[model samples]
Target: MNTPAHLLMGAAVFGRPAQTKILLAAFFGAVLPDLSLYVMAGTSLLILGISPQRVFNELYFSDAWQTVFAIDNSFILWGILCLVAIWWRRPWAVALTGAALLHLCLDFPLHHDDGRPHFWPMSNWVFESPVSYWDSAQGANWVAPIELVMALACGVVLLVRRVPIWAVPLTLVLMAAEIWIVRQWLFFFTNS
Candidate 1:
């Protein structure tokens, strides 16, 4: 699933606390796994003085980098973080970690052969589901439109529930941006 879908689903599932901090934590948690891309790109730009195009070209296309980032974003690490949060009695941390786990759960079934190593560090295992959320060649052409509809519905739910004024619109915009980027830039660059 896309980040916005994960965020909205997390919020819908765990929004009962109705606390701003908790909601924000959930939002961040949904996106935390994907931060490896930003971290790598930022480091490449700042530390190595690499151009953005080269960074994207290398990192997004390299199998080794993909494996490394997959391990970095694995479920085992997030699960351990959640366990630690519970042990430390940090409610917000627990909420954040729980939402991250939820994101992984959603992703587990949506990825194709190039799936995350969800059990990395413990084991280099990937589920490699037949369906992919973004790859049209991997039976995801139908999923994109359905996911957009679901995201819109989630946005309406958030608006009706009186979530922060910016939440729904921001979610929608982010969702649209992700769809656009995947369809226009990422697919074109990677596939061609």
Candidate 2:
């Protein structure tokens, strides 16, 4: 799933209208899994001046990068943290780790060739689902639109739950971004 979709889903699932801290925690947890990718890829594209093809095709699937992905995308680690948070009776912590776990859960079945080692230390196995959210050849033409709709529905859920006024325009902006991203995936990626 796109990062924006994850953010909206996290906010809807774990965020509270008045609890800024919890909402922020949910947002952080949602993005944390993808943060390393952004940082590494951004540095490669901008600072290191790497071509998009090499950066995504080669570096993205490298052992070192996959290792980092394993730790962040690990269901075991996030599940442990979630349990610890629940034991400690920390709602914010629970929301944080719980949302992260949720992110991994959602990502698990949506990824095809790009699947991560979600089980990690317990197992190095990567479950390559039959569908992918971004890969056109992997049913993304249907999957991506459904993802966009679900993400927008999550935004509506946030609104119905009486989220802050700022969330209204934020949702709109995110919707726009998701649309643009989908268009890019459908057109640019499919053509390539």
Candidate 3:
């Protein structure tokens, strides 16, 4: 799933309209899993002058990078945090961990070759699902559309709940970004 979709889903699931802190936590948790990827890839591409092919194809799967991914995408760690938050009776923490867990759960099956070791410390195993959100060879043609629809549905959920008026434009922009990315991927697949 795209990061923007995760953000929308997280907000819809764990955020309360009037609670800015909880909403921010939801957004942070949603993006946390993918944050490392962005930072690492961005640095490599921008600072190191690396080619996109090398940055994505080679560095992305490097052991060091995968190890970092394992920790962030770890189900055990997030579950422990969630439990701790519940025990401590911290609503914001609960929202954060819950959003993170939701992000991992949604990402669990949508990844094919690029699957992360979600079950981290417990195991370094990555589940390569039959469907990928972006890979055309792995049913992304159908899967991506469903994902987009779900993301939009999540947006509706947020709107219906009456989030701030400012959020409407942000949500629209995110949806548009998702649409553009999916279209780009589909075009690349068809052209290739």
Candidate 4:
């Protein structure tokens, strides 16, 4: 899935009670982690390559540094962060965490296909995705197709669930477009 998918999923998850403000917040939070992938940061894709994803993973979620954290799985860190965020009463905590979690879950399916490290330390377990290696331009197998389908499904569910009618079209469009954009970036530029 792309950033838009993350945003949309986050919106769908956090938009409960259906507030436009929450939906908007989750959308931004979903893509916030990608700042690490920008080249001017001196730590973007040009410098770190695909490991850019890893850096983002660790920047906010991975508990790789703590003796007691043992964050082999990102969810634990997210859960902990949620607690922290809630304690601080951060309005964006749930939305941000939802976006981040969606990003990780989407990556899980893709990681299996690309042989990327999903288990980190637990052992190489493919979630059985046929993605078979990550690329920026040409996503492995039918990633674009799959992403499109899922994005559409999410849109329909969101709409049927009575998400504001006006919001539906833009979210739907953004989700589809973002998938294509990320697919291109991950496969095409990464190779360059």
lDDT of each: 0.73, 0.88, 0.88, 0.57
CA lDDT, candidate 3, residue 49: 98
Using TM-score as the measure, name the better of candidate 1 and candidate 4: 1
Candidate 4 lDDT, 1-192, residue by residue in tens: 565666666676766556676666666656654433333224444565536555445533333222212232345565566678778876667777666666666766664323233343454343656453344334544565566566666666677777766777877787667666756755564645
lDDT of 1 by residue, 11-127 (tens): 766554656777678778777877786777789899999898888766665777777766666788888899999899877787788878888888889888656778888776778
Ranking by lDDT: 2, 3, 1, 4
Residue-pair clashes per prediction, in order, are: 0, 0, 0, 11
**Which candidate has the top score in lDDT?**
2
Evaluated against the true structure, the overall lDDT of model 2 is 0.88
What candidate 2 gets wrong by more than 4 Å, as runs, is none
lDDT of 3 by residue, 5-61 (tens): 998898889887437788778778888899999999999999999999999999999
**TM-score of every candidate:** 0.75, 0.94, 0.95, 0.56
**How high is the lDDT of residue 140 in model 2?**
93
Badly placed stretches (over 4 Å) of model 3 are: none
On a 0 to 100 scale, what is the lDDT of residue 9 in model 2? 90
Error of 3 at 100 (Å): 0.8
Candidate 1 deviant stretches above 4 angstroms:
42-71, 86-89, 166-169, 178-192
